[model samples]
Target: MVRISSFGVGGKHKSTKFALYCVGLFGLALLVDLLWASSNSSPSIYQSIVSQENVVFPSFAQIKEEDKKKKDGIDKKRVLADNFADLDAPVLNWEKMANAPVPRLDGAAIQIKDQLFVFAGYGTIDYVHSHVDIYNFTDNTWGGRFDMPKEMAHSHLGMVTDGRYIYIVTGQYGPQCRGPTAQTFTLDTVTKKWRDLPPLPVPRYAPATQLWRGRLHVMGGSRENRHTPGTEHWSIAVKDGKALEKEWRSEIPIPRGGPHRACIVYNDRLYVIGGQEGDFMAKPGSPIFKCSRRNEIVFGDVYMLDDDMKWTSLPPMPKPDSHIEFAWAFVNKNSVVIVGGTTEKHPETKKMTLIGEIFHFEFDTQKWSVIGKLPYRVKTTLVGFWKGWLYFTSGQRDKGPEDPSPRKVLGETWRTKLEL
Candidate 1:
């Protein structure tokens, strides 16, 4: 080989050229990476999950201490609240309007085309709310009351809409309303007409109802009594505003049901809440079971049924309260608000419970925190939305002899804005 370098000077000069070439290559590679990232518009900040040890439940005293810290001008808690708050902070000042009508609980509610429709709930042995109330957001009107084909009570049954027709799922019927019903019906919101649909295979009341991927998902709910909850699931596909008769598909199983009254569609998983494990006989004279003194021990368990039709148990609720009738609502795409429910011994004769607390679940972090308690313990239906603000309505409170009409139902509505 012909020698290109004679001694140390030439060798050192070659090394310098190699070093500059390596540096130039690195610079060119970085520039290309920056251009690719810019072209793809990738976010500068990427979310990463850090492994965390299992969290311990907060005691009442610990909760009080945290609240104190939040209220004591501590910037950490305040800033955390603002950062993790639901509903965008920009639209926190939106005006809220109420559509007051008759008091109703255990009714079905859904929003379609920016309008909310409520229908079919029970009141007393002799009274029931069969009239459907429609609230139009665009017009700010609330006067489309239609009657249901039948009345139901204490039933955990739910209703959903395909934007045109309302599908009323299985529920309890008869006086006292403890009878198991397999009947399914649909009401045309446009025509104000009702039609019977094929009944569910098994009789269930209050299975968490949600629309999953253009199909209906009914999760855990009570069967004969509240203690005997069913874990069977059902899915139905509707085309042309009508359910396809041949499209009912059985999906995954859920955890046991308890008077389950709350379910919502999020990330294609149905999150079920507040199921009962005791006897709940809405029937006139059905035998009540004595499983435990805690008549209404709310389930602290949170199960997420994913898109693959598999159920995953997320972190449990912070507390337990069974009678949280319709207490689940999606506040946004990534958060949900589980509102007030009942904890019982029946306050009268020292066997009553009335709890008024609200819990919020942050889906992204799988964390739960207590927001605040309600003015009073409530036992009623809950469904609403976070249209830049959280709007909830229509629940019942504790009953008394003077107001003893099976707890005069609530037509009251509330709005809370999340600072975030």
Candidate 2:
């Protein structure tokens, strides 16, 4: 972990010129008053106009913190208050599932029939993982272990399942995030092998992927090796067998979806939330310096794409506006739940802090419910919803602040029953 800090400085600077103008106006008023007093006749019309203008005066007083914060376009109160899940809030029964045979962060999970397949992602060994780990839902234990093609050892790749085949999109190959690969493959759950399939229209890392209504959706991730964001939306029609001659087509939206934002499918609508646009790695673990595009937002912007391809911006998540990346999951396309991710790094210690607060957004009310806090600290993790269970795995996690232990995840997978 490296210490990250950003610097920015800007202001209107009109105060100085305005003060000079006010001083000149005051001097003119004094001269006019002297002439009016010396004259026996009534004051001039222009002098009367000056007197009226003088009445528009206000006393200089100290500005409150809240008022100042409001002027600065930030609500510190809301962020500080809503950053945690209450200890006494609520919790459904959560039990440990089979420990992840391949525990890695930034990977993905897909359930087909009675088997759950965990795909490639960046691992704790400081390398990208191509090893495939599977767990059987019927047997309640780990299943087959396989390896991805050497070139497909990609991390941060877009992954989605059509129940039979898991489509693995482009992602970074080496430990560094720069080596984004264009090789996409599909895994057969029944055969336990991967086959070459239709690659993406363009190459990108960390692109959001979802399967809705027989169409595969990939949108809102960085392009050009994770340097810039493009509003390219690509979809492919998947039939029984894997065949593609004219399968992929791209459409440019009016306003592009958020780059690197957490995306999920809900209620037949595609949603992207709270992700950095240009670069998610330029200043990893860095603190925000100014209000601009360079700094990744704390709670990320929210958007929903309609069937007509129109994008609608929704209310921002009510969490601390730090740059640490978080994760979200949807329970049956109805309720959206956000869980563990890192918070802002401590200034002196320079350790990137963790967020314990868990929240569920209320659609009808436009508010967030501080549901409950996680017992452990999380930096990066995958949220997989299979059947009635929610599986959490990977991430550089640790014990919470109260535990006084260095925060880290020991590479274990756990699950809890989520009653939708």
Clashes of each: 16, 8
lDDT of 2 by residue, 224-308 (tens): 5465665677877664436344567675452553343566676677776665455445334334211122333234466778888
Instruction: Give all TM-scores, in the order shown.
Output: 0.66, 0.67
lDDT values, one for every candidate: 0.61, 0.60
Give the number of the best model, judged by lDDT.
1
Task: Give the poorly placed runs of model 2, Cα more than 4 Å off.
Answer: 1-94, 241-247, 254-260, 278-295, 320-333, 343-353, 361-368, 402-409
Query: What does candidate 1's lDDT look like per residue over 40-75, in tens digits?
Result: 542222112112655233344644554575477555
Worst 10 residues of 2 by lDDT: 56-65
Error of 1 at 148 (Å): 1.6
The number of residue pairs in model 2 that clash at the backbone is 8
For model 2, name the residue pairs that clash: 84-357, 85-357, 274-300, 298-321, 298-322, 397-408, 397-409, 398-408
lDDT of 1: 0.61
